[model samples]
Target: MLSLGVRQLDDILGGGVEEGSSVAFVGSIEYDNVILMHQAVLEALKAGKRVLVVDFRQPPSTLLKELRNHGIDYEPFLDDSLTILDGYSNLYGQGIQGGRNVLPNPLDLGITTAIIREALQGDEYDILVIDDVTSQYTLQSSPKIYIKAVVRLVNSVKSLGKTTFVAVCSDVFEKSDLAAILIPFDYVVEVSKGVVEVKRSLQPLRVVEPKFAYMRTRNGISPMKEHYQSLEGLKAQLRAGENGTIWLKDLRVQILEEVTERSLIETVYDFLGPEKGKELLYTWGKKQFIGYGEYSKRHNTSIEEALEDIFKFTIASGGGKLELVELSDSVIIIRGTNLFPSGKGYPYPFHPNYAGSLAQFLTEFTGERWEGEETKCEAMGAEHCEFVLRKVR
Candidate 1:
């Protein structure tokens, strides 16, 4: 038996999870299912089990950092007890080299299968951790094909007497589709609305009566008594997950499209003219900030705290790293590094979207109308972007 490291969860599972059984963690990103995966990994490692992590979400390095941040000593097990199959770099076409198990092409099912087989050859790993199964849908032409592939992979792992722990975002699937996907797993754990329940249990079947409720903190999961103290505290556990979705409490935001920095700039300039395009982009940014500000106010969050939270959210979503350089009654200055929306080779200053965002951030925070301008931009040969917001009139 492999323990999940949580006492209540273990008892619910009839002491512990069965070996060679495939367990599916079904949930949306807000529930911190990824942390559950990390906890399982730590437990498996402590039990002297060699683990294989097939990551399809983020860069393996970033995943490792998060695992470490959760206080899991994964580094010591690296290349020996732990081997990560990086599916992120190749899937995104970065082709980053120097990983033990780097996929040449993640979209190719055959390559993916062969790589996992190679890693599992000779009973090398006792546990298989697929950080997520939802990402496979993005690679396949049809959902039916990917579900078959998942079943095949799970069956193959079980054949080697290895355990499988996989995560699936329940929100991304239809009710029928989710049921179909869960059919292969021996155990299905559903995490939703701060409740962890055993949705399916075939191996020595047991019921989780009264459903286990838990609150996730930075350290780890804790069994909740009655209810969460703060809704905003729950919202603070933001995560970017499967299908390019960002979760904030119950809100699900999807990234609809991807455009290159230069193309976005040129297209806007050509379609709307530079001045109108800039104005439109600025309004877009301001609208985004205003919506967030309103949401924060509704939650009874202080403006200062809301500003900091938005900055962190921006960085987490790959917007950029922002630092408050200066703040006074009349002026606010923000320094941005590696701003994702800014192009490096442009001949002129080009970050009106960010400038507009800064203006709205100030206007909403201070209750004073503000105008913002980009004083320094990487597009204009500056090392970083600087936005200066001054009170209007």
Candidate 2:
């Protein structure tokens, strides 16, 4: 069995992929399917297995540079454990003199396959990575020839008891053609709509299931574990427009840009004095929450659920975490941790905005005027921010 470098994926595959099996990482043009393929190659090298990368996306130098960026030690393994076939150069008119094994014409499936099989037949390579099969659309003569070549390669690698990893953009192929390409693989991982789904697995013998979803962030893939259900529900209603707009399909409204706490507070302070700016921000926040409360009332949503949604949105937007500490007939206490550093130098309660919003939301829901005061604040050297709310006489 071989680790794919993603712990969750490895666990889902029942402790990693079975040896000698072929796997495909499939996704649309919106995703970089090659990332996982590169990750797998790095992991294979770490496991001390000799790896052969048939890169169709970039030149050998560029490919090695990328692998090094991923923190792989290159020179030590270059002579023994790692070998890259520069399939990109000659076909792309970069000349064939660039690497140890540069293909004469990668677009020619006959020559390409023969070269690959000869390399794999050697005892030097334990793993094979076709850095992407999607290039077939641009480089191959026809879909029939591409699919045939992929199947032939998979079979040849399997017969040699070597593992294979192939990356392909499913969006480029017709459903029938895509199916033909995937039919030769033992497992498939798919990326779509910001979620990484394991479409197929064999070691555990699992059929289709949502399995899990992941977010591709600037850092890398982050699994949506705790809030997966609610987040997925929200994601389901999101739609992108060709005009560079995003919409909330459920509400039939366009999503707007988010303002950061620092930007909002600092800009307001620059425009107005500290006290006046805080007052204005509080009033603005109160108005927004009142509207949300009205929406909850109109939609028959429970106050608890509405508040949960608000907190989730706040956390998602980098605001912070909020929790209801205590709720009574006469008093309410809300605690906020990891709050945005809004009032850096000011020795006062910085989150007047949130306090006002909560007060107004409760008042709107209960048909009573409410007021809130910040009893503790991180800005004032408190551990967390706390708001105490009470009904007006």
Candidate 3:
């Protein structure tokens, strides 16, 4: 077993996270669990244990800086005891060369898992920490692939008798998907504003006291006074008010309308031409969904249901009346009447930009790359616009 360096936390677990066992720290937007993972790393290092950090969120430099801010001297463990696999650099299209390994493609689960297993083979690492594992997988691959890879990695590490800590943001994954992923872990810790709730553990447990609170100081996480009387108090603070939520909804509507206007599309296409313009629009559309955050909540729903809700919301907000005319396991057809299409009379298909956006949205929403085409459009003298979507592979 590995000591987390916090007495109360270790006692809660009947020691610390047991060897050959995995623990997941599930957190949300307002409550961060990354700090707890960092503390574990620090504790492991201080105990003279080798640590392997597979970071998919922040850069390695940022992690090092944070360690320094916490008054942890990481200089001694640079290459000998600490090894970092920088996945963030790969996501941004950067090549990091030196002592550390850079994951070239995070989207390929087989490749990513192979690299991780290879790193663990001869390293003799005592602890493995995967930061923001769900976010990394969800952004590039389907939930099925992500869950498989996580289970494989965790089980492999457990067989090697090495402790593993996986951090996941609760807001990024659907409830069912999150529950599925958590099933494999031996322990599940939920971090919120005032409390760190241990929802599951292997050992017989006792009633947890309310005095457990984590405070971050220059020296790292330390025990502090409880901030709230109960978990309900924390939930009350994290919940958004009705007016605040409405204002956010209104703002999103205004921004989407402005960004997806016909004039802006024409200006972009004029400069970049059809191919590059469509590519830019597709990238923008994908990023918008990721940034919006709320779209992820529908991951548990059927693809058709999710798309219907999205189109309904869009139509209500003046995007257009989009009707899902056909839906199947392999194909989808959507007809849009009064869509914000260019009124300019065009002979050929001129909605490549919109088609690109639609393609990206479907891809992210359905967990597959969809080949899309604007079969009929108002620009081409059609009464309504029609889109034919099919799975790419």
lDDT of 1: 0.75
lDDT tens digits, residue span 1-393, model 3: 677666557756766877668889888774357777777777789888888888887788887787678766667787888888887776774453334478877667889888888777775787888987865756854787788778888888888778888998888888887888887799888876746777888885543341256655566655542212233322323434455452331242122553356667667778888767766765665555552223432322356655655675556445667788999888889888777655657555555545556666777766677767778988778998888888898
Q: Which one wins by TM-score: 2 or 3?
A: 2
Per-candidate clash tally: 0, 0, 0
RMSD of each: 18.4, 11.1, 22.2
Instruction: Tell me, by lDDT, which candidate is best.
Output: 1
Candidate 1: 10-residue stretch with minimal lDDT: 225-234
301-363 per-residue lDDT for model 2 (tens digits): 345655666677777645778888887777888899877754545555678888889888878
**Superposition TM-score, candidate 3 onto the true structure:** 0.54
List model 1 lDDT by residue over 1-393, tens digit each: 889777667756666788989899888967367777678778899889999998998888888788666666688889889988888887775435555588777778877887887677777888889888887775677888777778888888888888899989888776887788778788888777788777777554333162567777655665552122234444464568788788754567655333566577768878888678878877877886775544444322345545666677667666778888887778878888878766767655677888888788767655678999878988778989998989987
Better of 1 and 3 by lDDT: 1
Instruction: List the candidate 1 regions with Cα displacement exceeding 4 Å.
Output: 93-99, 203-210, 226-393
Off by more than 4 A, model 2: 67-76, 94-99, 205-210, 217-219, 226-393
Pull out the clashing pairs in model 1. Answer: none
